[model samples]
Target: MSERRPTLRERQRSETRRVIQAHAVRLFTDRGYDAVTVADVAKAADVSAMTVFRHFPTKEDLVLIDQPARLIAERVAASPATHPLVRRVGGALVDAATALTGRDGDEPAANERFLLDCLRLMVSTPALRARHLDSQYALQQAIVDALGDDTADPDTAFRAQAATGACLAAMHTALTRWAEDNGQTELPELIARALAASFGDDVVATGRRD
Candidate 1:
């Protein structure tokens, strides 16, 4: 069965976000992220600052909007938690990394360029780097919820949170290194290696533990 197409409203919203982000990136790259204001981005995109804020709550969000929190949560929710928590969390994050990097290995070349620019900005900007840590907490909570761990059980909660944290930390290391390398290495491979190192040989290229 074919997947349902997005509604007209959803399509328009997505297009608006795309246009705003494009203009924002251009301005930031041309005139340093610190020098460019949200008002500057709005003027370049020909939209109001209100519109920009509605789409991206903060200036840092314009560079860091595309996180994998929802994707990871959904993937974790789809699987049964019969396996070890570390394996479940590790597998989910590794799978999200593969999807973002390119499942078919044919994601547009333009997207690769865009990601590299965004990653570079995040690495160099102090405000964006700080905001990035906040996003990490949100993503960890999402995974914890998806796993449906018993919040009242101290041991179970710690295990769930620890597993998610370790996986996220591994992915974060891989991503930062990728930015430093200027995207020279394949992202999925870096993520796979990082997870394998953290998990001690359980993670595979396919992101399957079994």
Candidate 2:
């Protein structure tokens, strides 16, 4: 089936959200995340406070709004079922990381600095850390759902959550290292190394066990 295009209203809302995000990044970077209010972001974006809230419900969201986890979940859900489950899920996260690093144009070179700043802010903020944990839980559930298994059983749910946690850990380690390097290394390269460190050289390999 052909893909349905976004409506004009949808496009407008997306653009507005982007504008608000950009403005929020600038303000947060200049004044610090804790100091910047939602109203401040709205003022910078030339939008109402209500509009800012509509796009990003909380102050922390201005930095944490990117949906890499959700995108990874979608990729896992859409992966070929013939592959081994580990390979499919890990490959989906790798794909999502690549897309997030701008392989698919979701990120741009200009935004890398902004992203780094936001990452630093999240690292230092307690509330943002809690929100991040909440996001991670949602992402974990998403991965379990994508696996197409009956995860109602405690053991089944635990395994699914464990695998998802590992994937997220790899991505987090890579991102933290990349930020520490001040954008000198390509994000995808670091991501690959981190995943390999966790799962060995054939991180996403679907080969039979020896």
Best candidate, lDDT: 1
Clashing residue pairs, backbone N/CA/C < 3 A, model 2: none
Model 1 lDDT on a 0 to 1 scale: 0.80
CA RMSD of all predictions: 2.7, 3.7
Clash count (model 2, backbone only) = 0
Candidate 2, residues 65-175: lDDT per residue as tens digits? 557767777888777767655666677777776666563244346656667777776776788878877877788788888777646688977877787788778878887
User: What's model 1's TM-score?
Assistant: 0.87
* Number of colliding residue pairs in each model: 0, 0
Candidate-wise lDDT, in order: 0.80, 0.76
TM-score of each: 0.87, 0.86
Q: Which one wins on TM-score? A: 1
Give per-residue lDDT, candidate 1, residue 71: 78
